[model samples]
Target chain A: MPLRRWSAAAAPLAGSPGTKQIVVARENWRARAQEIAAAGGRLMALWASGPAATGRPAPRTLYAAFVLPPGLLVLTMPDDLAHDEYPGIEEVFPHASRMQRALFDVSGWRSSDPDVRPWLRHAAWPADFHPLIHETAPTAAEEPRPDDYAFVRVEGEGVHEIAVGPVHAGIIEPGHFRFSVVGEKVLKLEERLGYAHKGVERRFTELPILEGHRLAARLCGDSTVTYAWAYCQALEGLAGTPIPARAAWLRALALELERAANHLGDLGALGNDAGFAFGLSQFSLLKEQLLRATHAAFGQRYLLDFVVPGGTRADLAPEGARALSDCAGHLAQQTRVLRGIYDEHAGLRDRFAGAGMVTPALAARLGLTGLVGRASGQAHDLRSDAPWAPYDELAPGKAGATEGDVAARVAVRFDELFESCRLIGRIVRDLPGGTHLAAGLPTPPEGALGIGLIEGWRGPVMIALEAGASGSIRRCHPHDPSWQNWPVLEHAIIGNIVPDFPLINKSFNLAYSGHDL
Target chain B: MWKTLRQIARTGIVTQPPPTGDGSLRLREALQADIREILGRALCIRVVDSGSCNGCELEIQALNNPVYNLEGLGIRFVASPRHADLLLVTGPVARNMDVALRRTWDAMPDPKLVLATGDCAATGGIFGETYATRGRLASVIPVDIVVPGCPPAPERILAGILAAIRASHAHPRSR
Candidate 1:
């Protein structure tokens, strides 16, 4: 059978269509960003990784931007990109500040921003160790220094600093946060991540293309389907092989199950954070039910490794489809009951409503994307907009709001949960039947750059794959949505009482490891 | 009052399930068998992160969820090596984490088992042997079993642990 190709231009006007391009001034990044923003493009991401060229001594800095509906535009600096301290886009996109600092530390590329504070390099390794460039084995003598975080100064008589952990009471990943405050109101928040940086990006270069799928899947395990599929998509684009229709359908089913599971658990956890045990119990139960259904279908609760390059590992049985349908019906019914509880609980409503509100202006300036971005009025879902296999045919609905507050985020998640349930049902009902995987992928073309953009549970998971010698990955960058939203959390907590930080923080649920990569 | 009673009748008025079998008995049985296999006879686990993004930790965490109920199997994760029976590590052993991984292995007592969870842990899955990694977990720590998936399903993880325990017991002279 002949292969099919979907145009990136097929994306809806407001969907996530991978890379968006815009030209920024050479060294005057700020000026160029203003020009691009004025032209209606958003500063989606900024990073400086790798050398100017293969085996080159100079660092290569790439400042990327994306516009509404999806197009990725990148401005690669000259060989002197490292020497030229690019003007920071912090003044305009505020969120780019941390990424700028990260680029400086990871690639040794300097950012002209005065806030020269490190973002991810918590001094976990020696100052001389730039893993992205130099090739030296790690030693036992290396020590992870205690993070010395400097919160943004508010300069008030009663202002004090509250530092939270790289370790917390909850069963969550490690990351530190410092809050500067006066009384109970937060003035500023400084985040210290990379405590869980496991050196994922560098490791990709060593694995074979076939094995890279597993590594990508773990980038954000909850969205294993999305990560694996995205990684596979990039590899296939490099190899130029087509994924089987049955495998594509299975991947969709797995992805929808993943999305539904996360949304259910997150919504419940958000309610739990507000002391709504009823909502937590109900949602957790539903999430558990959903996972069980997934296990029945895919042999895993979280659907890990179900997707591989060129297709899925297994086909879904009709029994599995029936189980999914049954699970969806029960979950929807239970959520309806829980929704009333959330609405009736004045105490819960009070904490959630108007809390951690990000105005539309702030969201736009910061380049927020995903549900948190969508909640703040950025309606972009890769499935509906970018229209990848399964989603392309089904055209899933996206839920968004302009409230830009914790309440809005909660509403968006709830709406997404319901929509995901429907998507899952649609997928199972219309599942294609055939071999779930292809015999093998074609040899990856040398020096090809393949980019994959998929809507992960948190948001868009972008993977850029560059093939190297012997079909091995050269530079694989997995950018988690956390890079775009973590800064927004700091801004969201401002003017809000310090006690509600957990509630606010869970609303974003950014991954420390994902960002550290 | 009556409505509440009706709701209870509709959804079942209990947070607890039966001690033995439930509607998900097959899954429960499989999970239990995995737990029994992986954690048989005071198993010691040493977590090695070959090189991963950390998405697998979610499913690893799910192992503790009330539904899957990992603790019910008597299998526990230990922080140090002196008391461990099995090593359950994730990742492909990033260049930076390689030394830490080896040292952690050396600290463990002899007759200990190693189970590599997630694809990275198994074969440098996504984070292939880049400039940073020294290959997969087995390169650093002798792996008894390799759970070959990006992030093995929690049940699969449970299965991996079981397999590791069986491999260790069956071939005490292999290591």
Candidate 2:
């Protein structure tokens, strides 16, 4: 099962940072997964895909990625033969439960682990209708069936269930969370997502190559630049094509700008949620200004459509660079000023301190990464850890803090904002003079598996793309960091008053649609 | 208050300009041209979320954002298809969302305009076709105006709204 415990002599090849190799036999996947769990690699995501998105199914491919300290590890299963459902790694890692269920729902594959309920399949469609199945039998459409989701029951005196959205009063995505509470104390919180399930996985087969990037970029709009870059990386990797150096730098610039913009906005919103309106006003204004500069440079704001398969679409002009530099200068200055305000404000401090805290110990156990993880002391940034593209030359280090409270989250954002500002400035100063994009993407080899790991504003976004012959997409698994972080929100909300949920939730700001997809 | 003033002055920037009926004069002319080609009457709009994180939904909801005041433009997002004159969809239309998306399109009355807002909806902008996506909005449903951006700025969103309204007027029954 352990696949002949990795020898000390093989450490060089086994432990290389760019990629880590873990060998597992086809028969002992479940056991190897357990070994991965025992070795502290948290299973982050599970997805199933094949040649076609919908219609006659081919061999179902199940791919799962594990998060290790040094980097990430991925395992693939053909899902073509009948095998016992692999043992769920949830006992060692609670996060793998949902992913196991998702694999079951997406592919007709079953998980032996008992913990099972529908993951993303809402009752809007029939129960028997498995959209991911390759072959479809013709039948008359039946009326949609109502669902009876059996949530875990907790029996106690004065313990009641509080159900809130897939729909809510405030503007947010649709996700139903059931909290079992005793008076004001939350005893348990359970989530039912996929309310906004758009069946993104099934639609991939319907898209041509050139048009696929459009869907990839929107996987999580907030992380548009990251998602697009990851998809392109996979495509380019498959084609064995190198994007122009200038295009690569431009992509990194756009990514960092996006990081800065989101961090500013989130820090302000986190502050606002903690009764600090000034933080909100200042950060929102800064984000708006940053977005305006992005628009000037990239034609539209929020940095969408800026990255294509081969390279970027828009090239930065000279005046645009100056304007961006000017904006960064102003932002960096204001960030310092606001940091003083945030640090000194007592009322804001009272609400933020020790509230919705994710202890460093728990954070590491959960394998939390990205800004939230950094705030909690699990220091890992893909930019530094993975070091892809310009990042290798730049060698940016991960930013982190030990205090895993709302304050730490805010501080993490602040630190990242300055880092982004510096990186953007460096990119502009070291602007490569070359074409923005490479020529046509070459056809892919017969069968190739390419993985792309990008640091989105949210966290590390891992996309594994398997391409068939003639440049068509065979299987793609786009994993959002939210899959690992959303569960942590439930843990963070414990013992906190109900009203402060928004503050805590916003601090994490995980994307539901991205994970659901 | 002094600090606030100093901050504003130091940045040398002001709040976004007050809401103008037509974003700019040329934009207004585009609107007028749309009206002239079609009609100046009120048009019913249909809102569809092709597949987005719902951030755009927030800003779109902010069309009622108190300041941007979208209803003033006669831009309405109708609930049912019988009343809708145009369709505005968001997100990248995830795999599971395809059937619903097609059904939503079918529900709309004929002579309806399709406005794909957000980069995701426009060309499958960011949420590119993975195992999770069907394709761009145009690949599945007919699209008229493609508003490109991850989540377009509110001003650009408003511009897109105006453009969609104009397109609907200019080419009635075209879709």
Compared with the true structure, all predictions reach lDDT values of 0.68, 0.70
In terms of DockQ, the best-performing candidate is 2
Model 2 Cα lDDT, one tens digit per residue, A1-517: 2523541112211111344434434576677677777776667667766645443436656666776656666666665366656545666667777777777766656776687787877655555556566445224233323446888887999989888755344445656788888888777788887755655565555566555677677667678888888888877876778889999999999999989977887887788788776666677777777877887877776666789978898999998998888888888988998887778778878888887899999997777767899999887777877677789897775678999988788888888889889888889889899899998988766456666778887888877776654656666677889888887888998888777778888899888778887
DockQ of 2: 0.18
The segments of candidate 1 whose C-alpha lies over 4 angstroms from its true place after superposition are A1-31, A52-63, A68-70, A80-82, A138-144, A153-155, B1-10, B13-175
Top lDDT model: 2
Count clashing residue pairs per candidate.
34, 42
Q: Model 1: DockQ against the native?
A: 0.16
Worst 10 residues of 1 chain A by lDDT: A1-10
For each candidate, what's the DockQ? 0.16, 0.18
Best by TM-score: 2
